[model samples]
Target: MEPPSITSHLAPSGEVRDIEKAAHTAAPISDPSVHVPTDTVNDDGLPPLDTSPRGWLAVVGGFACLFVSFGWMTCIGVFQAYYGSHQLSNYSASTVGWIPSTESFLLFLGVPIFGGLFARLGPTVILIIGTILHVGGLLGVASCHTYGQIFATQSVVSAIGTGAIFVAGTTAVGTWFHARRGLALGIVSAGSALGALIGTAVIPVLFDRIGFPWTMRAVALTYFVLLIVAIATTTRRPLPADHPHNPFRISHLAPVSLLGHSPVLILAIACFFYFLGVFIPYNYIVVEAEDAGDGVRSSNNLLVILSATSTVGRVMPGWLGDRYGRFNVTIGFTAFSVVLVLGVWIAAPWRTGRIAFAALYGFGSGTFVSMVPTLIAQVCPDMSKLGLYLGAVYIVIAPSVLIAQPIGGVLVSAGDENSRDRYVWLKVFSALAMTVGVMGFVAARASYQSRVGKGKVV
Candidate 1:
């Protein structure tokens, strides 16, 4: 048999599907047994978008989850610095780097499984379990004494919980809004930037006053409260009223055939390369600044600046992406990130220059991070299958996130561990890696345009 055509899901009329009725009518009842039959296709094979207040509320819930989950992840630089100077001070930078690397690896690694679970068990169960694991893992991290213990607590335990929240929160937003997806995702993603900005500033203060253990406990408690709010507000598919399976079966989810689809293939390749180098700066820039003689306080402030600028970077691209194309905005920003890495970052030798590089690079990188998923959602053959596709995509990139920072650590630790010049090669490596990332995006965009025609908004 011939492979399936993605266009089959699009409306023949080429007009946006009116999902307002379904949004209002489907699953209005409080019964969990109700399953609303969704319009799986519209003019673009996107669900009928309901730009409802409730939908935006789901966005807020997602925002909260990301704030606690990814926000903490983004603040890895703080921990990297802390661990190197204090707890794991005896370990080499490259060895100490593995902790956060493992954390990132697990964060993306479980997406496929989580995606499968989201489709089967729904978001509520996933959110609740994720909240438990996340809170518990953080508490565990607070009390852990050794490198191995910290790895088990923060990396394995905490990472899985973060992944669950990530998959559930992001996919929940997808089920609600289609037209405003880029904007919604952007806003939700900005929560990470907000969280990072706040955490980077507060963490050091907390570390000094109450110390590491209580600081982590305090963060865990805050996460617990926020996750509760997130779980309460987030709902998947708004209770589909007529579905056959009361408890969904994994077999009923989107088939593996989607992996072979052109868009999926190209997009996955793009994401793999993009992620490989994308995280390096976020993970290592503060360390680089610290090594350059800024010391601890200034390095933490640099993280704050980077994340503060990233907040704007995260949201603005979403708005721009909605009007322009997501691919256009993403590609533009990804390319600009190359310049920031090669130019501003590599050339910056002083405090002022480094600060400028932090802000600009953070902003440029934020666009790529915020808009890449929206682009993926656009090319997805079925709106209903987005979680599955994202899961697959993240699975492909998980290794990249796992190794990117460790590789940076190796480069910085090359020859002498204390040499500032050691970081120059890492910068060069990131620039080269990001260059390949841009090429992947360009290739994917070209392939998408060839099939859909250049004029389509996607």
Candidate 2:
């Protein structure tokens, strides 16, 4: 009765009774074999899986998607230079400058919205839609004669499509690898650099012979082929039975929680300034070179060098981040960028130094892009929330692009017709922003270290 008066239920033998008492007082036993560790699983019940052959194939496909999507954006600088001289020559440099900047801004801003869509609709549907919109946007741009048409077709529609495809492709890669996530992401992200290199080398040749419309069409065709490969090869890992639906509820989209987090906030600020500065060189370097009378062919060659150098910089930094720590590597690159902007870009009085600056800035900026996402992954718990967080950051970043390119153009436009004062101002802004960005990045890294102790290791 009454559980035999708890103590009375013990075995008669003293040893057994003592053993039972000790067991009762001891901590609850955990079943090591049965309990899955948090470190071993994604927020989904999926176990930490190795990169499979199929996964590698998917990575290759995803790389192609990234290559086309980002490469196309990088090619915008070249387009801006060309269009500023040709179809849009009638428009002021500052006005025409909005086209590529708007496109880049939209590409960055559109990610979170499309990321949510990707989570719901799945990558296949999103990727297919992206392919159509991307190609269609190019075609639309090719047919357009006015600035409004170019903005509508190229800047808004195409950028949105590229953002969606990029989110899907990168997220797919994220889902497949954990241990190798940084390396995998780096490899895929490098596609943009590769695409830039290819575009820089090829687009100019096409522009000289086939013209902008045909060249874009050729680019569109390349995107189509690459997207088909991505769709066929890429896939999401099977989510666990208990995995939460990644619904884009208004609450999930609320920026307060992530924005309030110091690391994320710092990251957002860093990105804003980083974009503000980085895009200047990208948007104006060709123009500056041309202003210096480098010749159109030489301007194109400078872009090719920047693109090729950037390809290596993007990938190597990712691999280095895996070893040296993401934040550390990122800050290092950002600092280097500031120095290049000030020392190489600003001080350059001749063709050789300007070319050197282009190559240096390209490599440095590429490293920054490749490492930021990896750094973000370290701060966030749920991979599904990556889009929301990244999007929020870009919300700030988008405006920076909107302003930066135009301001650079205005600076250039204000200079004595041949003085290159615009470039001088562009370099000044880039250097200042990069310096601030590096500081922001350092703050972010310190926040990460404070929360999760240094030497503890990721």
Candidate achieving the largest lDDT: 1
Candidate 1 lDDT by residue in tens digits, 179-260: 5677889998998889889999999999999999999999999999999999888876543343223344564243344556
Best by TM-score: 1
Cα lDDT listed for each candidate:
0.77, 0.73
RMSD vs true structure, all candidates:
6.4, 10.1
lDDT of 2 by residue, 1-458 (tens): 32222122212233234323332111111111123233344443344443455557768877887887888888888888888888899999899888988888887776766665655677788798888888889888878888899999999999988987887787776666544556777888899989999998899899889987888888888888889999998776555454445445764433435576676788888888887888687767888889888899898887888888888888888777766677777888889988887888877757899789878878888888777666666665445455555666666677887788888888777666556454676678778887888888888777656655445343
lDDT value for candidate 1? 0.77
Check candidate 2 and list the clashing pairs.
none
